[model samples]
Target: MTRTEELFLALRQQIVEGKIPHGHKISEPELANQFQVSRSTLRDALARLKSIGLLVSQPNVGYSVISLSTEHLMEIFYVREALEGMACRLAASNITQEQLQNLRDLLESHESSVQLKSGVAYIQEERDLDFHFVIVQASHNPMLIDLLCEKLYFLVRMYRYQFGMVSDRAKRAFFEHQHIVHALSVGDGELAEFLMRRHISASRDNVERNLLVNKGVIS
Candidate 1:
């Protein structure tokens, strides 16, 4: 990879994994010195980060890592619930046998990972095992694909990474995924959509509940 690409990946990992604090102002000179890259190369990396929604730039304030709030998290999950529901609906009609097999393989791998991790969900770390991503790709809709895969998915991942989000519904989630896959395999668009929406809604509810408890809003 080129210098810019290398720097971009390094920064992306740190930011996504929460190694860099949320809303931390990025110091261009400090980053350049630390990474041993030139100003132009560092700017290129910063620009790439901005493109991915991990960093925000202002006219004079420079760049800061994107800070996610509870409101923002709920909004994102709401959008994902609707869009990904449609994606699953369409995928039931458009998904090919190969895609179906790929999803099954992913679930199998995830099952193994869950077992190895003592039942902790492994979805946060592994990109290839991203169940929602794989389903969205099967939808075969360009706009939906771009919106979810290209736009919102990273932010969702960022939330998970920063919060150390692990679903309490791990076993239930596995079964739900299986049911959704079966719905797609049978070309049951309505069932697939319903199941997907419910699945995502459950996740949103879980997060909200956890947040409320964390803040002592509910005991």
Candidate 2:
């Protein structure tokens, strides 16, 4: 990657990983110095992250990491349900046997982790992402891939990471993924879409309930 792209990737990773923390102010000059890049390059990188809604830029206020409210969580998943559900359907028709096998392998690994009570580990969560990502790519639509993999996927990860993933939730999510992949393996487009939509909707509900509980708005 070119220097600009490299810097962009670097900063983006930190933001999504919550290394810099949500709503943290970003100083362009300090970041430029830290990355040893010029101001223009840093701005380019920040702008790219900002474009994806990870950062907000305001006049006189500079940049701050975007916070995920319960409302925003629902909004993000609403789009996720539409886009990823469609991707799952297309994937059922378009995915190759090799890709299907890869997903199986991923689930197999997850199975081992779950059995060992390590399914909620950050590594497993990332591996879960790999399983979904493969399915999204299998959709064979460049626009869908770009929208999910490039943009919204990171935000989803950010929310998941920030909110938390308990072992039980992770284990349950793993089982759901198995069902979705099974639909894909069988080339059942409609089933895959239904299962995938349900999967994302479940995640949104889980997050919403958790947020409400945290706020003492729900038991």
Per-residue alpha-carbon lDDT of candidate 1 for residues 1-219, written as tens digits (9 for 90 to 100): 999999998998898787887889999999999999999999999998888788999999999999878988899989999999999999999999999998998878777774435655546344446889989999999999988987677777888887874656777788889999999999999999999999999988988988887883212
Clashes of each: 0, 0
- C-alpha lDDT values of all predictions: 0.86, 0.81
Off by over 4 Å in 1: 114-124, 216-219
* Tens digit per residue, CA lDDT, model 2, 1-219: 878899988887898778988888998888989989998888888899987789998899999989767778788889989999999999999998888888898788767764436655423455234777888999999999989887787887787676665634676787789999989988999999999999888877877776766794312
Steric clash pairs (candidate 2): none
Best by lDDT: 1
Could you list the CA RMSD of all candidates, in the order they appear? 2.6, 2.9
Worst 10 residues of 1 by lDDT: 119-128
Q: What TM-score, over all chains together, does every model reach?
A: 0.91, 0.89
Give the lDDT of residue 96 in candidate 2: 89
